[model samples]
Target chain A: MSRIKACFSVLKESHKKALIPFITAGDPAPDLTVDLMHELVAAGADIIELGVPFSDPMADGPVIQRASERALAQGTNTDDVFNIVEEFRTKNDSTPVILMGYLNPIEVMGYQHFAEKAVKAGVDGLIIVDLPPEEADELTAVIKPLDLDHIFLISPTTHGVRLDKISEVASGFLYYVSLKGVTGSNQLDIGAVSEKLAEIRSKADLPVGVGFGIRDAQTAEAVGRVSDAVVVGSALVERIAEHAGNNEKMKKEISSFIGSLRTALDSI
Target chain B: MPEVMKNTNIDSLKSMPDKRGHFGNYGGRFVSETLMGPLEELEQAYKKYINDPDFIAEYEHDLKHFVGRPSPLYHAKRWSEELGGAQVYLKREDLNHTGAHKVNNTVGQALLAKRMGKRRVIAETGAGQHGVASATVAARYGMECVVYMGAEDIKRQAINVYRMKLLGATVVSVEAGSKTLKDALNEAMRDWVTNVDDTFYIIGTVAGPHPYPAMVRDFNAVVGREARQQCQEQAGRLPDLLVACVGGGSNAIGLFHPFLDDKDVALYGVEAAGDGIETGRHAAPLNAGKPGVLHGNRTYLMEDKYGQIIETHSISAGLDYPGVGPEHSWLKDVGRANYVSVTDVEALKAFHDLTRIEGIIPALESSHALAYTAKLAPEMDKDAIIITNLSGRGDKDIHTVAALEGITV
Candidate 1:
């Protein structure tokens, strides 16, 4: 079975929404990245999404942008991201890691090579924010050979036509953006989002991961009531960016944050 | 080159680069995979249009009638002796609408956008010259226009930002990293990703993925074509030297395009050395940068050890850049064109001298080119003619100059 399938099997058996926490690889400093990855997984993250910093990430609002800037300022690149993953895998290997970011770095690294590298680094999936289904085919063609899940994004603006298009290729989960705006925007429309989740479920068999505007415990639990995975990115990125230089403090804050998210999801 | 087009002014005998993109070693497309299809499509379209009898007529017709082409090749009578160089003549591209040579390319690309049935136009502007030019044509063509500007640029060039809005263009002040031209480019790329189906990205300079550098160069080459023909007709011989400022190097390439085949004419590219190149405070990418993939193409870039782009500084907002067009790389390697730079102090001196002597105020961007002429002209013979492109008039730069000099206008 694919790692995402195996991961979902755990979620199904436990009857708990997956607590998906994200942190930019090499934020604050490159050396501290691998340690932080271990703390989050141990703290109750069912899955981890590693952000590869691009010079411009439009889908991200201010918090994540600052996180990425810190990571980039510490001189992070594709090599650094993969190395961080490899280090995380040295001690703990079961937690599925999803490589996430824009497409430029992947394009620069070449699609086939990036796929092989990600698989080698023990990556389970990808969540490129910019790659639409039409463009996802570019990476999917290369990644599918490695049995990697190609997660896709469906937003509130995504209509009947685009949802159908996304359903055809979405694997592991469909990332339902709760808001139309960028990550860390104002508020999530619970009614509209659940309707979007229902709309996606009608056409596809994949589990839905709701993100973008999910911040606190209440918000996470509220979204987890409807979606299979509550993917919290900006808030976690904000936490990392805030405590970048202080590693122990950063790990404590991150683990506590993810633990609360996991509790909220379990309660839901 | 035949100069008539059945009431069309079609230049029938023109040439294109070979598959590897070599235009006599002065122009060629050296790029990566990100821009292959777009560049190929652009090359095919540009080749077809430049040779097409109808395209020539319409393009040249607009250049003459609409844009008021063959702009004055003025003899700088007072400035000539003041610089103590061979008498200098400036091909006044600043007289073109939108106040720079940029509109020449915008008009061409906008025409192509119209032909492609695209309704929305998106562009990235560094100093807002190209943004204003793009907005101007978008207004004329009745297309929905959106301009992306770095937040820093929007603050500095507020006048041009307002001009774009006045022309009914939506000005998006991008607040990404550095908030400069490169950031604006990143924002425009994001916008393109979102709306690529209906939008045409009007790149400001002869740089970007691939087709953009070549396409922008071809369109703006009107400056060189006009200057060369007019210089020969007026002086009865070609200039000893031709000069223009280099940012993404479009103006330099445009002015050098027609003169490259002229073996007698020496081409000079002038870059802005903001403080001094030695101080590591300069925008002279050709002189101080290394080759790298930046701004979607392979070219000379100002990057640090880990490939992070360094901030470039120059008094001239337009010429303040950390990279140059790739064709400039081919030119520098071939020894076809020589590039040099002038410090901000020298450019400002040239700026004041030109305003005082010739009653001509040049944009600080163009003053870098004039700085080269001011240095070289005095060393040449009286009969040795040096022609430099006065790329834009200096009205936009006057406040900047007054602020620096603490002089009341």
Candidate 2:
């Protein structure tokens, strides 16, 4: 099962929301991803969203974009992403893995093949940034039998009708894009977020996980108070960038940042 | 008046975008997986070497002594009389070495590229200005330079193509996409992807993933920093407003940075209105764009529902692009700056006005700033100062303008 679903189990028993730390799969260096994944989990990542590097990631911010540049620079593709996941499975079998990426590579790989490979490689969920909730029927049909959860995004711009569709379709959780703009923009209206959260909760049965712009413990706590989880990618990516070229420094820093974030989420 | 906006933490690490760029929604690392690692390395390298006294001192010395920065803040006495209203000041960025504001960033980025010990550099250009600047720096540093330009831009900007060749730069003509700036950028990125092991990609503006927007803005901020102090020393106060044309927004952003903290100073970025704003053929991203992703980062982009960029048109080849920097978006929302648009007709008229009155021909890109002044001057007081960035000299546009007028320059 997906670590995301397991997080809810931990949440139900501990009365604390989960902390999902996002990291681009190949950053600082491509060879470092699998090791970094283990470090993130040990550092308090209840769930790990491993981003597959794509040529274009429309939903990402600059930090993530830079990560993509590093991975793309090194020529890390979907096949490489699967290999990384397969390797991670050898060391960590209990943690659920989510392949968070755009749809181009999956489309290129063919849905039937991708679903099978992703499951065999130990991935439990998929979050294609560009796949709107309505258009996911084709992929869902292919993956439903495999029992892999399909995650859907719920933006502040998402209407009630769309929220209802996403809720029915999403099995893992609802990704709440905290703002209307793309990831890494500079402003957020708390009032707008609250209103959108109310809309999702009113219709969606799945846990609403808020992301985009949750960069610090203070901000993560603020978001954790409002939802079942707080997804922080840029913050973790920033730590990776902070210790570029030094594997030990990168891992240590990432763990420290995640530890702080875990404490913040649990406080809520 | 500046006291209200003065941030005392100007010299603190507290100003950084928290590794993730959470400037209260105005910034973050909205990039893809491939670039994240290298970007982090870049950030770390910048942190280690960028603030070194020697690195900063070398950069500053080159700016003042080599590039001849503190470029003149000239009083456009003649143009002011032509407008018959407000006093006008011209921030003469065109007087800088290499004949444009682009060299400022090129010099900074090139220096950083050298510090990283990268042996080769690649860049993208639209009007060839950035290509020429990059080529110049690569030659100075004895580095191999590859510049990508649209097949169309290579044709229109032949002189710059020749200059790059003379500088021993390989100019790659990109024909993919619309065969324009966007396509050229895509091609350049492809090169970076293939060669990131040994090559450094020098982006030309205040856009792209994190650190880049801030980094480019700092390099170009020399324009605003000098102009601000000069405007104060000479004019005895800050200008009532500041205006510049936007094209990848390097020149405008450079000129706008220092003034960002100046609350009373009204900043304006005039985008190319082209045929007209409503005609669906302009580059006025701030006026018409929705917040969609483009070119690896999220900013105001001219795109369709499917995220394919719509074709853009402008009198200036450089301004014929579909996005604005993220900083401009932040500024637009906070009301620190107002973005406006000017059509080809107004820009042409301003071009004519500057040529006839001041004997200075400006590039179509700079003409957008002139157009803003034409309208804004008539509305302000005679004593009120309005400084405009004459981003580049217009000699290269002589062929273009001559064709338009049915006369040879």
How high is the CA lDDT of each candidate model? 0.80, 0.79
lDDT of 2 by residue, A78-175 (tens): 77788899999899887778889876467556789989999888898998775654436879999989989998877654565655677888898888
User: Candidate 2: interface RMSD in Å?
Assistant: 12.4
Cα lDDT tens digits, model 1, A167-189, are: 89878787877764456776687
TM-score against native, each model: 0.73, 0.63
Q: How does model 1 score on DockQ? A: 0.11
Query: Considering summed lDDT, which 10 consecutive residues are worst modelled in model 1 chain B?
Result: B1-10
Model 1 residue A175 CA deviation in Å: 13
Which has the greatest DockQ? Answer: 1
DockQ of each: 0.11, 0.03
Candidate 1 lands at a TM-score of 0.73
